[model samples]
Target: MKDPVDILSALADPTRLGAIRLLWDGEEHCVCELMRKLGASQSRMSRHMATLKVAGLVIDRRDAQWVRYRRNPALSPAVAAVVDAALALPVTEKAEEIAA
Candidate 1:
């Protein structure tokens, strides 16, 4: 069985971290918004998202052509705590630039 710590480590990447941070603020976000906020290529963002999904850190729903993602509230208390902590941090300058 895969270690839960290893799953968390997968989400530790800067880019994936940023993506999770962005989703932390709101209920959900479309792929384009994530790509824009992270300034990542579609493929790159997709890969990171896939990692998060595999880690059970994120959940996704499709809206037409867009796939929206959000933190998995159903996660264990420990994981939810980590996600809450990440959301508390101020948005980074890079994230702002991408938001703009």
Candidate 2:
């Protein structure tokens, strides 16, 4: 909300970055899928997504029992560029391990 720095800082964590990377594909994903992808517990994933919401990086919708998320359509170009750059980097060890 303050600046691009705030968005970048929110993504500084492994889990948050990974979550954003998954959403960058342009499809909405439920919290359950995010938890599975990131190898995080439900509460942990919720917290990370909450951080994303507060930073204006993602948008969410509730579908009965599920909550789905996607990259915020209204995201600033500068902030979107930062997310794109972060995802372009090689996968982190933790990410690889989780995928494996």
Candidate 3:
């Protein structure tokens, strides 16, 4: 598990939170797919993903021209619980407000 502060900080952003919600299903998602769903530019989406990666909340793999992302499966039990709790929370309108 990463520093609790770092993990929590990563989830503070609406964009990253949106990405996490999309990934909560445990399915691999291409960057392009996330970009389309979130209405974010490629660079912005990638940058936010980098933050999530640094926080150890997500892992990625290069796939030819695109990168696929998924929630980190190896999170410590405590961290996993935190993430699960966050995901379980009902979505608010503010959380769905991803900037263009």
The 10 consecutive residues of candidate 3 with the worst lDDT sum are 91-100
- Worst 10-residue lDDT window for candidate 2 reads 1-10
Q: What would the per-residue lDDT of candidate 2 be over residues 22-91, giving only the tens digit for each residue?
A: 8998899999999998899988989999999989999999999889999999877877888898888998
Which of the two, 1 or 2, has more lDDT?
2
- Rank ordering of all candidates by lDDT, starting from the highest: 3, 2, 1
What would the per-residue lDDT of candidate 1 be over residues 1-100, giving only the tens digit for each residue?
2357856686557788878877776489998988977788888889889888888888999999889999877777777776677656777775466555
For candidate 2, list the clashing residue pairs, or say none.
Answer: none
Output the better candidate (1/3) by TM-score. Answer: 3
Question: Where's the lowest-lDDT run of ten residues in candidate 1?
Answer: 1-10
Against the true structure, what is each candidate's TM-score?
A: 0.77, 0.90, 0.92
Model 3: colliding residue pairs: none
User: Could you tell which candidate, 1 or 2, scores higher by TM-score?
Assistant: 2
Candidate 1: where is the Cα deviation over 4 Å? 85-100
TM-score (C-alpha, index-matched) for candidate 2: 0.90
Q: lDDT tens string, model 3, 1-100?
A: 4889999999888889899989988899999999998888999999999999999999999999999999998988898888888878887787766633
Model 1 per-residue lDDT at 71: 80
